[model samples]
Target chain A: MLRINDLHASTQGKNILKGINLEIKPGEVHAIMGPNGSGKSTLSQVLAGNDAYEVQSGTVTYKDQDLLELAADERALEGIFLAFQYPVEIPGFSNEKFLRTAVNAQRRHRGEAALDAFDFSAMAKDKMALMELDPDLMSRSLNVGFSGGEKKRNECFQMAMLEPSLAILDETDSGLDIDALRIVSQGVNALRREDRSVLLITHYQRLLDYIVPDYVHVLANGRIVRSGGKELAVELEKTGYGWLEDEAKSGEVAR
Target chain B: MKTATPDKSLTYRDVFASGQAEEKSWARYAAKRESALAAVLDRGLETRGLEEWVHGKAAGLVAGDALPVRGEVAAAGSPEMARVAGSHLLVFVNGVFDPARSEIGTLPAGASVQPLSAGDEAADLGSVARDVESSFTALNSLFWRDGLQLILADGVVLEQPVELWFVNDLAGEAGLIPVRNLIQVGAGSEATIIERFVLGQAAVVEQPLTEVVCAAGSVVNHIKLVGGEAAGEHFGSTHVVQRADSTYRSWEIVTGGHLARRELHLDLTESGAKCDLNALYMGAGKQRFDLRTRVNHDAAECETRELYKGILDGEARGVFDGLILVARDSQQTSAHQTNRNLLLSDDAVANSIPRLEIYADDVKCSHGSTTGQLEDEALFYLRTRGFSPEEARTYLAWAFASEVIESIPVLELRAELSAVVTRTLDVVDDTLMGELS
Candidate 1:
């Protein structure tokens, strides 16, 4: 469903993602694990079309179309959803209202009619129930005064609401309690479809135990040096990325 | 008193003289009006050098040639007039109270509504809103032909709000209309007063003065709505005095005008008194909106809260000046003031000044002001959700001002104001798009 060819991106003349390549087929769940400052978040941001990051040289194809050519919002309308690492707190805007606007925007892009308030509320209530979020939280300002776990659950709820074909979970497991992680994983697992793809970005292997991935890629020093199955995550957790860094350095010297 | 400019003062003097000749029974009040006018003429129209007039240019607004008095126009109600449910409506045409149009229904015992020109009543008429300080207030007191007097005796709790509707249909003539309202709420009484203005497409000047006295333990909610079309100018002042253990809340919403200036002065006199002042103003085209507010905490344990928001589009200019004062004996006084503005166009201007004066050492007082364009992150967040750029901007601007608009006590009024705000955003969006094209 997605292909990255020699993805080379940087910000302010500093290269972050250097010569990275990956591919994911339909219905596949890919997990990218790395240590701190390993360019895990930068890869997600670059994919989501953040203007702060400059694409030095790369080609990202989504469903056979050049994804980098689209604007951030246009990419969203094209069913590319990025669950932000830090959900923005929009003061004075109700979560329900923001969700409805977003849902209707995608619907309009797909040539569908806008849902009325009653219909939208009914749908939102069901999604909130699935995410185990209090119905009252939807009436409050978007992410304002929300707990960290609540913000993560809200991101999951948005992913459920938008129902994007390609969902990028950017540290969605960060700052979440065990119960919230379970709820978020259950929501994501329920949303899995044959024509959909998921990209999981995390620093720990704990989230993989809930929503297990089909393939695991270890990103180190702006490049993916290791690719394995779900068991590789458990092995990496037992050992560490330190050995992989030494191996990559020696392999580069031999090349 | 000596005048700096004789010709500038004579213009107002001649207008006051003609107004006095029409109403002979106002002999006792006329002396007070003459002195107030003389004071204004001596000061020569609040210059920009004054602290209060620093952001607002009051000279050009006051120096216009006095228009001839046109006959009374019809009281044709427009769609923009806000109609409250179960309200006692009092209609005024061209600043004169219309008895036929007014509905002075069966009021509760101890509650009365009468024209100020009907009888001699010591109802604190010119006590709260002194003429010496404001030229507009002085001009209103001098030339006002008839004014409304609302009285609520002690322990009277009114369930229905009293609606004061002023409609100005000048029909292309340049004229001046002075309106005065004196409201006195007795101790332990509760009442809501709504004043709405509807100005037609004409070059007109309206000077409206409202004085409110909240007795001990009473609650008063005052709402003012101004809607102007074309080149109408409005100079409005609301002076409120709160006694011990009383509460006063005010909401001012201005949507349209060529030049609109509103002054709000609230004095918390006795202990345990509380006051809340909230306002939302929007300006488009060459419209200019100015709001000046002062809250004085006189006794111990008094509290004051204020939030003012402005949205400026086109080449509109908005000014917000808020001052909170804590007297020496007013310990434990809690006062907070915030002013926020949203500028849509590059040429649009917003000036905010929030000041605090605390003579008491033990007091909690804070003031803040922010003026900037819409947040890029917020706009992007909204856009990513599927809204167009225009839709995103409109939603954010509406949300920015909704914080103050939602403070209205009446749900119906709040909904009405929300609808008005939405329509206003649509217009602003269209105008901005037009400018871009």
Candidate 2:
């Protein structure tokens, strides 16, 4: 469902993603773990079409379409969703209105009739239940004055509403408490399907306990140093990335 | 050849005689005009070179002849209007009041709407006639053809709002139309009023002068909306006096006009009185929007708060000047004024000045003005949510402006203004203009 090749990106003339190559098929989950300032979030932003980063020499393909060629909204219409690390607080725009607009934007792109208020409300109610979100929160401005856990759950609620084919969770677990982590994981798990894929980017292995990944990769110095099964996350959590740092330095010296 | 002092020298013939109109209304208010014009000329149109009026300028008043209107005068209003039920409606067209179109039965007994031509201004206007000292006020005084006078007798509680709809149709000719209004609320009375200025297809201008007196223990709320296809140049002056223990709230919302300037003056005369002023101005193209407001607290225990927001796009220019004054005897007075402006394009310009003069040592007075571009962090966050760059910019701009727009007490009008802001931002898919019409 998603592919990246030689993804070389920079911001302000400073290279963040040196060279990245990744491929993931449908119904599979991939976890990318890295420490702070390791270009993990940059990769997610570049994929989501954030214009601040310069993609010097890279191409990202989502569901066989060149994602880089499309605008940010077009990418979302093409079923690419990026759950932000810190959700934005948009005043004067209700959460329900935002979700309805996003849903209709995708539907319009797919040549489907837009849902009216009643139909949209019905769909929202069903999804809100699945995400364990309070209905009152939908009436207030989007994410304004929302708690950290509430914001994270709201992001997952939006993902459920839009039902994007390729979802990128960037640091979604960083600010979540244990209970919120479980709820978010449950929400993500309920949305999994045969034709959908998810990329979980995180800095810890605790979230893997709830939502096990099919493949795990450790990113170091802007490149993936190792790839293994879900057990690798547990191993890294126990021993830390000391060995991976040494391996990266030795590899750089060999070159 | 005598030196003209600001208070009592100079004549209207010196400043306004265009060598065109053989009959001018400046004759009616000559005493008022001579005094106000001398003050204006001495102040010199608010230039940087002057001490006061330093922030004043003529809003694109050209040196051309005042053209005559050629379009069909808007038909008289109908008494059977159903759009807004239970509203005290006063309708006017081309600055002429249409009694047939007005539905005034909604007003409680003792409140009356009278035309200036029906009786003597001295008897009808009462104390309101003595409050005109500005040139704009004097100009309206001399040339005002008809006015809708609303007076609420003491202790009368008006349940319905008074809607004064001013419709100007310049079908073909580009002309100037001026309006004058006086509203007096009696002691312990409360009322809400709306002054709507609508321009038709022709190019024209509407300059209105208004004076409001809120008696002791009374409350008043007023709103002004300017919109339409007519290329209009609107200049308005509003002077309000709040008696002891009275409350006054005013809002000015502008959407469309060629050139518009609004001057708001508020005086707190009695102790325990409070005033709240809020305004929103949106400018596109070469349109200029200017707002000047001054609040004077003359007695103790008076409070005032003001917030003015502006959004400028294209080559538009916006000017905002707010002044708060506390007299020496007005102790325990609290006043604050904030002006925030957003520049959407490189060519858009905004000038903001917030001033405060306090003679009372124990008073709380604060003023601030800020101009800013879109927040980069907020923009990036929106973009990451799949919003286009333009959409993100529009959403952020609306969020910045929502604080002032949401303050309108009337829910329907507040929603309509929101839709206006949305269309002004060029985002969103729906509009409320059709419904308003």
Q: What is each candidate's fraction of native interface contacts (fnat)?
A: 0.41, 0.39
**On a 0 to 1 TM-score scale, where does candidate 2 land against the true structure?**
0.82
TM-score of chain B of 1: 0.89
Best by TM-score: 1
The CA lDDT at B318 in model 1 is 93
lDDT of 1 by residue, B95-175 (tens): 767777778677899998766666465547789998777666666666666567889999998889888888776655456
Q: Scoring model 1 with DockQ, what do you get? A: 0.44
Best by lDDT: 1
Query: Which pairs of residues collide in candidate 1?
Result: none
Instruction: List candidate 1 segments past 4 Å from native.
Output: A12-14, A235-255, B1-11, B24-28, B64-82, B118-120, B171-173, B427-437
For residue B374, model 1's alpha carbon misses the true position, in angstroms, by: 1.6
**lDDT of candidate model 1 versus the reference:** 0.82
**Model 2: per-residue lDDT, tens digit, B1-437?**
01111211323344344311432333444454455445544433223454435665654332223322212344543323232456787787777667777677755687876654443353424244333344344445544555567788999888877787777654444555656777888999998888887766555667777778999999998888876642767777777899999999989987677777888888898998999998888898988888989898999999999999889999988899888999999999999998989899999999998889999999888989988788776777665555667666776777666667777777667777777787788764342122111
* Cα deviation of B63, candidate 1, in Å: 1.0
Candidate 2 lDDT by residue in tens digits, A1-255: 888888899998899887888888999999999778778999999988888888999788887888889877778878889999989887666787667666766787798987877899998898888778899999888999899999999999999988988899999999788999999999999988889999999999999999999999888878887888999999999989877877876774111
